[model samples]
Target: MSMRSPYPDVEIPEVSLTEFLFADGFGDRADAPAFLDGTTGDQLTFTEFHGLVEKIAGGLAARGIGKGDVVALFAPNLPQWAALFHGILRANATVTSANSMYTGGELAHQLTDSGATTLITVSPFLDRALAGATEAGLSADAVLTIDKAEGHDSLADLVSSGAPAPELTTTADDTAVLPYSSGTTGLAKGVILTHRNLVANLLQVHVMGSVTDQTKIMAFLPFFHIYGMTVMMNQGLHTRATVVTMPKFDLEQFLSITQKYAVDRLYIAPPVAVALAKHPIVDSYDLSCVKTIFSGAAPLDGELGRAVAKRLNCTVLQGYGMTELSPVSHCMPDDRGDLDLNSSGFALPNIECKLVDPESGKEVGVGERGELWVKGPNVMVGYLNNSDATDATKDADGYLHTGDIAVVDDEGVYSIVDRVKELIKYKGYQVPPAELEALLLTHDKIADTAVIGVKDAEGEEVPKAFVVKQASGADLTEDDVMAFVAEKVAPHKKVRVVEFIEQIPKSASGKILRKDLRARETEQA
Candidate 1:
């Protein structure tokens, strides 16, 4: 039987995202701070952020970028990124976010796949952005550099022209953002999230007391990731909260900024919580101002989460979701005295979830371990350009097959047990072996490679590569294989273990025999 959220259904506004955010009487003070640059202390008030969004929207419109146009936003967390993202939406264009750490080839795949005609990136990531734009058949003029520099125009230049805002022509069902995800299988594909999906999720989370004007959020999570895009940046803006932006995560910098800004709400991953629970440096900083720590992106060790909360004297909570579910479906309540730290909390206000036997495809009883299926307004419209994948993931009945094995207790709280998919989770980031294997095949030394996740010394799942080297590359060491992949992908996705094999186990249909390798790994352990 399906379980509904304990809270009553909320009335979601049918307006556009920008309209919802800039609506009248949303916040008490329009001049109050909305965002701040953690490094430079640069600030944008609510009123200013709104006007700049309009100006940038106008600018993009003036440049012939409007409804149905696709723009790629590649940047780290920054104060202006909020404005830039909303501006793209205000122009009624879809913004596909590319991870800032992506190589030119990686970024190019997204640009070409998403059909993004325009690329916006900061000065640091300009080289890859330009190369990606070229590879995607875009001209240099199509690249808009965020930093105002010679030869390249910046976001400032676009906003300075002061073009009038273009008319918004979009339906709630139109795709707004195309964040890529490697759905239960295969390579990364664009998750088609409509405007309604995003707004519904924001409201669902808001009704749960996740964010408000009193929330002083620290935006350290990469905005390129959907969790940061919706939870920290969008929710912070929708509530008119003060968000302190960090370009990247550096433990020292994180503590310094959080303390300096008196940040009350921290949207973090489990790794950060682990550090706070065990790291000695955490005691050096006074974190008394912090009230709530919302952890997502991966499973949190209940003991570790509670330990961190005890040390900081704050409420540490865990939530669960994926890119396909608008990134948030279950979250712990703010008052956490009665909830289980291991549970992912109750389903959000409009979401319904069920535990179903994977093999039987029948609904499971309470406390039974089965794959989790969720149905909600926040579910993605579909996978872009891939109807087969869309059909495989979301059923005609609208329930999304989440591939995650979970169990619900008598109280209706859910706990994720394992993933039925081959994707590896390195500190909460999805690392698809298919994507990595495809990249590894291009390496000169590699003849064949099959990647799988193995538990590291830290009890974390990391990509381990079983490789077949070319005769000429017999001297290739494990370090060589690791470095070869490290240069191409993000840090968390780097190969941690390497094993040389003469033949790769596979089926007659050419599917990787991962079960055989997993059994071998179990024997070795």
Candidate 2:
């Protein structure tokens, strides 16, 4: 049986995302800062932001980029990134946001796959951007920069075109953004999220968060990820909050910015939570202004969440979603801080979820674990140009098979336990790697860790841990590491193998890159 959200459904506007965001025209908050650069202290007021959006739209239209055309945005989080994003949409074009950490070849895949005719990026990333454009069969003329470059048109050049903004022709059903994702298991494929998906997620999240125009939200997560695109950037715009942008994460800088801006709401990944909880530099800053720290992207350990909340004297919340769900489906409400920090709270309004036993293909009752399937307005239409992949993930009934195993309590709160593909099996017993990884993180000597299923000499699959030890823990032995986890977990879930690494490989969004670790093991084999 599919379970509905405990919260009442919120009305999803039929207009485009831009229409839904800018319809009221800023009202009395026109002069308020919409985006603030945390590094340089530069800002764009709501009025200026809207004007830049129009200018960017006009510039894009002048370049023959309009309805159905796709433009690639390959830049870091900046106030201009937000403007250019809206500008592309305003011109009735779709935006394919590429990961900032992507290599030239990696970016070429997205450009060619999304059929992006133009690429926009900053001057510093010109090398990779130009290389990607060239590899994707695009001329240098197709490349533009956010800042001035020797031979390229800049965002300023776009605004100087003086062309009138095109009329809004996009509807809620039109594709708004194409963010690539590997989904449950596979190589990355473009996820087709429509205007309705974006708008619905914004409205759905609005009912669960405490953000307001007066709230100062810190956005360090990459805007290219759907989590930041919807939960941070667009949500800030929707609520008229001032978002402080960080191009990247730096420990001391993050703390300083939080202090400088008196930022109240922080949206981060679990890795950032680790730094907040364990880093000594955090003690030097005054984070009293911070009221909440919301974590997503990967499962946040409950103990880590509690540590950060206690140390910062603030509320810490977690959410569960994937790229296909506009990246937000379940989250703890601001007022519900009393709930378990481990659970991802209730489903957002208008969502229906079912937990089905993977092997049995039967829906599980509350408290039983199964793969989570979601249906909602925020769910993606499908994978772009990959019907087989789409059909494999999303069923005929509109339910998206998330492939993440989860359990629900009688209260309807959901806790994501593990990914179906990532779970380790030991002697016919299922072992969730996340549970072991989370347990390992609680050890003082372990800075970071990743757990994966590796075959032993007997050809039996067993759990192995790749650990990054703290600087002070150089003398800590592998036996000590295994023993630490062994004492807490069942025999089937023991970390049978341990390898000390300098760092655990992670994606920009903070998910453990288990495939990379597995490849390393394969190379050795």
Winning model by TM-score: 1
Clashing pairs in 2: none
Model 1, residue pairs in steric clash: none
Candidate 1 wrong stretches, greater than 4 Å = 25-27, 471-473
Model 2: residues with Cα > 4 Å off, grouped in runs: 422-525
Count: clashes, candidate 1 = 0
**Candidate 1 residues 11-77, lDDT tens each?**
8778777767776744566888888999889999888888888999999999999988999999989
TM-score of 1: 0.97
Candidate 1 has an lDDT of 0.89
| Local distance difference test, each candidate | 0.89, 0.90
Which window of 10 residues has the lowest lDDT sum in candidate 2? 423-432
Question: Which lDDT tens digits does candidate 2 get at residues 1-525?
Answer: 899999999999899999999988999889999999999999999999999999999999999999999999999999999999999999999999998866686689899999999999998889889888999999999999999998999999999999999889999999999998767655568999999999999999999988999999999888998988999899999999999999988989999999999999999877688789998999999999999999887778899899999999999999988889998999999999999998999999999999999999999999999999999999999999999989999998999998888999999999988767675545433466776787888999899999898988845678899999998898999999988877655465689999999999999999998989999999999
Q: Model 1, residue 216: what's the lDDT? A: 94
